[model samples]
Target: MKYAVFTGATGGLGTLCVKELSRLANWMVFAGGTKEAELEKLGKLPNIIPVRLDVTKQESVNATLEIIKSYTNKLDAIVNFAGMTSFTSLIEGESVEAIEKLLNVNVVGTARVNRTFFDMLYQGHGRIINCSSESGWMTPQPFAGPYVLSKYAVDAYNDSLRRELIYLGIPVIKIQPGSYETNITQQVYENFDKTISNTKYYKKLLTKMKPLMMMELNQKNDSRRLVKTVIHAMESRHPKLKYRVGTGKLLAMLELLPEGGVDVVYKLIFGKQGHL
Candidate 1:
């Protein structure tokens, strides 16, 4: 039996992926941070079951895996999309909590998902879809340092995991999304003022980054950006190991370029002094 499981199903790309997964898999599990009401509503569908699985909690992850195991020894695909954590440019010591939370949820959470679900993939001979970010390649805006770090770490680990899984004949795929229309930016906005107001080092540029974050806050993701990749990763006979969506070929080329070249390009764009 083919099954699909999704985390972060409450909102953003996760919610959209859950909707799509419902169409493809015989059974679907929706794991969320704290959106039980919505999950219950989604779970009401004949094939969909909403399970509370906070990626940050070991027991929650274990219980969710047990539910999947009970359904079948095999899972077609698992979307590790459980994260609401972000970082503001300012390191207000207060940001430490969020920083830790972001890493714990995104990096450690992904590892936990991979570990718990690999057995099902081995059984069904399927794939693991990890939602990486353009941030995994580069940090564009300020005050989002921790998010960039965590994503970068996840990207690296996924690459390694993908390689290891080849021996098991289960593929691990990565989706690198550009700024999509999602609730993530709202979190950035909510923390924008407090994060900057609490810091003194980057005050001169605070007003500058305001518009950037505000612009980002009001933005919404093209659900298609994520949907298309999720489908390709699941359905295609030869799904790509990495999917880089949106923003045309230029950015794709940029991500492909070596890191030193990328740094030179960044310096050129920002006109910053060379340090290396």
Candidate 2:
């Protein structure tokens, strides 16, 4: 039998992946999340073991490791999806505490879980799948600095981790997905609202940015594509290092420009008075 653990199991993509994984024969899934009610629901599913995990806390990650160890000595796969997003101006609107919290959840949290479960994964020669975002590689936009910074860190962290783990015959895979229909959009909007309320200078800019942000969020693709890519990474004989699903061509094209050129583009978009 194969054993897998999925963090962020209560989330849209996480839940979809867990349900699909549960349908596979001889597979046991540990659905880890912070939501008690959602965990209870997942626990009712066959082959699903709901584990309460708050990846931002070391103790919580350690406790989850202990819980999983009780059931199996080894884990065939560990998929990390526990992440948070922020939509605020880094210099003027967002608090340092808020930025720190975002980093803790999206970057440190992922590392903590992987570190806590390393021994078990090593024992099984398993793979580590990290859910990064298209924002990780694309040229970042204004007001999304915290989230973009966190994802870029994830990308770098995963690259380094993969290089180290390759010697042990454990492949570390990264899934860089584009905007998808997920609860994260709601959280992003909430953060945006809070930023608007708190900002003294970026109010006008943020006001103009709102509709553009809305359009981007509304253009999200079905999240099932991401789930399918994740499953492919888990089950394939030789999975690629990175799987990019539904990435945006325009953002990607922007990434190819020189630093100065990109700066000019942003300046034109936001204008001298910060009106789009």
* Top TM-score hit: 2
Give the lowest summed-lDDT range of ten residues in model 1.
267-276
Candidate 2 lDDT by residue in tens digits, 1-276: 999989999987899899888788878999999999999989888899999999998988888988998999999999999988888777774457767997899899999989999999999888999999999988887778888989999999999999999789999999998877789878898888998999877777678778877877777677778888999999899999999998876577788899889989877776656433
TM-score of each: 0.84, 0.95
State residue 69's C-alpha deviation in candidate 1, in Å: 2.4
* Cα lDDT listed for each candidate: 0.73, 0.88
Candidate 2 segments whose C-alpha is farther than 4 A from its true place: 274-276
Q: Write the per-residue lDDT of candidate 1 for residues 135-156, one digit (tens) a residue.
A: 7875343467778778888899
Clashing pairs in 2: none
> Which segments of candidate 1 are over 4 A away from where they belong?
25-27, 30-33, 139-141, 216-221, 247-276
